[model samples]
Target chain A: MTEPVTTGTEVPHGGTADKVFPPLDPSTVSPQLVWLAITFVALYFLLKKIAIPRIGGVIEERQNRIQRDIDAAERLKDEIDGAMRTYEKSLADARGNATAIARTTQEKLSAEVDRERAEVEAATAKKLADAEARIAETKRKALSSVGDIASEIAGPVVKQLTGKDVSADEVKRALTAGAGE
Target chain B: MPDPIHQFEVKRLFPLEIFGVDATFTNSALFMVAGVLLSFGLLMYASRGRSLVPSRMQSVAESVYEFVAGMVRDSMGEQGMKFFPLIFTFFMFILTLNMLGMIPGFFTVTSQIWVTAALAILVFLTVIVVGFAKNGLGFLKLFVPDGVPIYVLPLVSLIEVISFFSRPLSHSLRLFANMLAGHITLKVFAGFIIMLLGAGGAASAIAPLPLLAVLGITALEFLVAFLQAYVFTMLTCMYLNDALHPGH
Candidate 1:
């Protein structure tokens, strides 16, 4: 199996060195080729069956993790949007309720004021009518009393002055004329 | 009488020789050690700070890493990340060895059949082990083409097996042959320039033509060094892809 190495040159006087470093025999193949084949086959199996799959699994897992993170971000965004919408709606509802309450209170206060005014007007009108009636009655009483007292004093004077006249009616007429003068 | 082959003989530097084994350090061993040390030291220094914002050295390191990384990803897909370490190591080692050879007095390890063969064998073995572990007995299906008639299975399987077995041989030979042919051609052309100059007078003026050719070949060899390393790593990814998916 030990072949003479080619020196890239031709020489004349080939001696014992030619025999020692013989040209490689083409007919006789080297066994190293067989060993190389065996080694190659064994290595291929080990890598394909074990190492590649493990590495591939790691790659796939990394991709899956990235995808999951993206999905989680999307979910969080949706939740935040929903919460914002709910908050806005509640705030609007609260404002609407407050406005309604304000309007109702305004109306109630106006109605209450109107009712109180009407009641006060009614009481004042009734008290004014009673005062007017009392004044009219007192005036009538004062006018009748003055006429009766004047007539009584005037009848006594006429009776004494008109004795020869004979009748009470004639005496009353003369007393009225004296009193008027 | 000078032996032409003796020009290629390697000499040891150290005086320590054990049992005529010539264990003393040689030019090839020196370059190999230099390549390994240079690669390790450069990478360590480049990645020392490991900053988020890269320095100049870190940028260079990152570019190399990303280049090889992109190659693996493009050839083998996302699943290729697992093989990053092995693929990166192979690319760096071959690249270092190839580039180191450009320096004067340094030997190119890839020019040797044993070195390239060893690398190829490692890749071949890795693919096989990976394929079997992945598919179990079903890994044998790689040797049997799907959709073939049962009558033709034996022929197809045999061809497939032969082709599969030929990978290491082709892989090794490709690197070894390119490096060997390139260096030899350079040497031969350089020898011409020397021979012409030694003739003296007007003949020395014609030496520039061969000298120019040597320069051109040297540039081409540099390109080849990088190309060969790239091709080797690319093929490794392809084999890894096969192991991952046997029939496909």
Candidate 2:
């Protein structure tokens, strides 16, 4: 704080506040403008010709590539959906066909079993009818024979017990009456 | 030890006079070239291997591209894309110059009002040329507000014209003043550190405080460097927008 702080005035150069402050300085304006123009125009052309286009191109390329990949993914997804639909359709069709085949086979087997059962029943009925006819015929013969025996036995016993011979007409009449009783 | 402003002195690096004009290439010119070369080198190197997946430098390039692109596109619409190169060039130039000034002993090119004003005037001239070329007689409509009464139209038009003409002044002064003031502030604070240290033992202890402030301001100045460039580019876009759509 003791020593005075020197400003731009003592710089020994021409660029002190006295000259530089009036931004409209005649000496510095033209050169600065000239250099600025030269460099700026050069820089502009450099950017236009090289820098911007390359950077912009690469970014645009990347974006386009990403879009293409997304489109491909969407297309593949659609294909998968189509394939799955077809597979499901075929599976349903196959299941229906199998069910139809099973039902027809089941119907045919049931019809065949019914026919066999009917034939077996018819044969058993015929056998039963023959056996019944035979039993009836035997029963008729036995009844007729029992009647005759009864008559003959009755006449002999009567004759033995009474020690008298009975007439055939009387014996027949008595046997008939005893048989009726 | 002499003066902080002494740092702003423009020393001629090469003496060259053309057509009886003192066009000796000065330190300002040197840094101006340096700024251009730095920007070109950075951009060229960054964009050399233009990759889909950007490398670090590639990202830097892409970021700068998108940043300027967005500024031009948002403010001026698709039609404004034509000015991207110019705006980008200006942004890079000013940004590089501002940053160069931050170096220990480099010249702050933007701190020179003439330099900044020249850039502003260039933008101003471009706006005028483009405005008239695009809109013809309609460019004058920029001075006439749509809602103003006929009687007050003259007054409003004068105000508009004044404001329109003031664009270059404001644009150039904004950058120049900011760079100049920031440098001056830094130099003054930096001067404090030396003065405090010069005061010897006890004062030197407090010198670190100003040194700390210098560090903070230096960081702020770095941000200002980028922001000023951005502001200049944004304003250029806005002015260009006025040219393109001169009706309102």
Candidate 3:
């Protein structure tokens, strides 16, 4: 702390030897402190007023922008998801309608085939009955003719055997009585 | 070899006498202003773009700001944001000074005890003023520890008081001593290389040893420079934390 406050930095006036240790020197301390306070105070105000706020503002602005961008991206993603869901729902609905249409057409076609089959079977049955009736009439007619022919042949044979002619009415009555028995 | 202490000598660049006081603008003052101005200009210039995506220089500037900003926030919390400007000033100013001193032949302002002592005293005074202003009489409760036995409480309190008062001493000396010793070691190692090289054949061959030591110690000094700045700022934060919430 020895101080006579010299004009130069070193204690020895003319020597080039830097013998005075400035760190421990008491003489230069006040000026060092004074300039320190001056520059330090100046620096404090410079940073406080201009540098810090500007940098901080930039950082804060970037953060806000990032958050906004993220939010927008999230919203877009949600919209895309909504659109995807709608597309899937409609796709499923179309699939169900196609299946229903195919099933209905199949059922309708099969029902038409069944109705035609049933109608054809009924028509075949009616035709068979009509054919049977006509056949039965022909058979009845032929049997009546056979009876008449039999009556005539019997008369002729009786005439030939007995050498006498017999009436058709009498033969007919005999054949009828035989058939009944 | 020249005086190893020669680098620390303050040469008067511009002499000014104000009312019989020697407030001469020395080399130390020149570096102080240079450090302050360079950091200020760099930060201002880096942030000039204000780009959402920062440039390399901008990122570095922002990182430094955020580093100190984060330090204050962690130690002192959101309420301490009011002191952010002061804290930022203290951090960057001291950081620039320490880093500038790492350059060959540059004057280290922090190597002086008065400057560090003055800064420490400023922080000490800030804590006292802020503590009393924030908590009034409860600021004194900082010395009282929780869960102490009632009988030994007085001894504990006295010890706490002593530690509390010694904060500035330790704070100032920690930075000054670290810088002084680290620089001296580096200078000594450097001196060894010159001495060895000045000697003839075999001794000159081994000069690389001290040169290597100089290199390694220089790298270590860079770490120490940054570390001391960080330590000083961190301690300031802790002390301010006490001021903000003096109960603990």
Candidate 4:
């Protein structure tokens, strides 16, 4: 015990303290084992009954909640997709209806313009015919008047000419001869 | 100046006999009970809240549960879930004991060979029981691995058998030795600092060396404390897997 091993303070005590390594001491073994048995059994029961299940339930419940939340989010996404589809369908239908309405208006306006043009052409032709007929009648009347006027003039000129009371038949015969010449 | 081994000594707390045996409760027993109560109490308190959104402490408790559960699932498959309570108990109890021992005055229960041996033997027994129960006599296939040369199969089987028997020995001793050695090293370094300071002269100037070593070792011991508990439980799972499926 008095041996100078690494100068006293650095000593590794072997013979001192009941001459037994504390970890391998015989007297403490049985007590520790007994208490360990009690401890292990008690801990196992405590964990099995209360601790494990409680913590496990909390964790499991959290996991289930997360899964449910994910499912709900997925469902909402599907609903949004459905709504988008409906919106797109209505948009396409409205576009098609607008095009159809514009096409129908154009066709109706074309038909109306054609009918009005035909009515105008018919009225103009009727007016032209009436004017030509009046011209023809007036020309015939004028020709008859010119013959009377020439007869009157010729009679007056003969009376004033040298008291020559020439007969109308003579005048007429003269005129005819001149014409034939 | 201080006895490093003295920390491992078990003292009589309530000296009483049970059925004519020296079953008087000792300091070692006290720590075991403390470990039990600490583990159980913390888990109990942590899990008390049933909110869908777990509190921080609850989350931690759940992580511990999930950690062991995941380990068991990884090593032993889903069927190993039946042993979850036992495995969880081992990890939490040992971890609690190891951590509590880090406090200056508390006894390190796991430092004792007897305690660690008991734990390892329990796992060993569990493996054997489960192995036989699950595979019947086919559990011996664990030793005789597949694809050994036909002539050396006997030698290989002999080695496997030896390793299989020695598992409990190594398992128990590994934890015990690590804890005992680490704590003793820490105490020894701490003692050196004091011894140098007590020299009261130029040696005191060099006391910072042991102080630094002690600080570093303390950190290492903390890591080792958690690591040992992790390793012990991990092995427990692997052994259980062997029991569940004894094939190579």
Top-scoring candidate (TM-score): 3
User: Which residue pairs collide, candidate 4?
Assistant: none
lDDT for residue A64 in candidate 3, whole number 0-100: 95
Pairwise lDDT winner, candidates 3 and 4: 3
Worst 10 residues of 1 chain A by lDDT: A21-30
What CAPRI-style quality would you assign to candidate 3? medium
Worst lDDT 10-window in candidate 3 chain B: B1-10
lDDT of 4 by residue, A44-128 (tens): 9999998887878777777898999999999999999999999999999999999999999999998899888888878878887
| Candidate 2 local lDDT, B1-248, one digit each (tens) | 54666666666677676676566687778888888788888887987887778899988888888999999999999989988888888888888899999998888989888888889999999999999999998999999989889999999999999999999999999999899899889999999999999999999899999999999999999999999999999999999999999987
Model 2, which residues run further than 4 Å from truth? Answer: A1-26, A67-85, A95-99, A102-181, B147-152
* Each prediction's DockQ against the real complex: 0.02, 0.38, 0.52, 0.45
Where does model 4 exceed 4 Å of error?
A: A1-17, A113-181
Better of 2 and 3 by DockQ: 3
- Please, what is the whole-model Cα lDDT of each candidate in the order they appear? 0.70, 0.84, 0.88, 0.87
* Residue B132 CA displacement from its true place in model 2, Å: 1.2
Q: Please give the lDDT score at residue A131 for candidate 4.
A: 82
Better of 1 and 4 by DockQ: 4
Better of 2 and 4 by TM-score: 4
Q: What lDDT does model 4 reach?
A: 0.87
Identify the candidate with maximal DockQ: 3
- Worst lDDT run of 10 residues, candidate 4 chain B, spans B13-22
Q: Which stretches of candidate 3 lie over 4 Å from their true place?
A: A1-21, A81-103, A124-181
Q: What's the i-RMS of each model? A: 10.1, 2.5, 2.0, 2.3
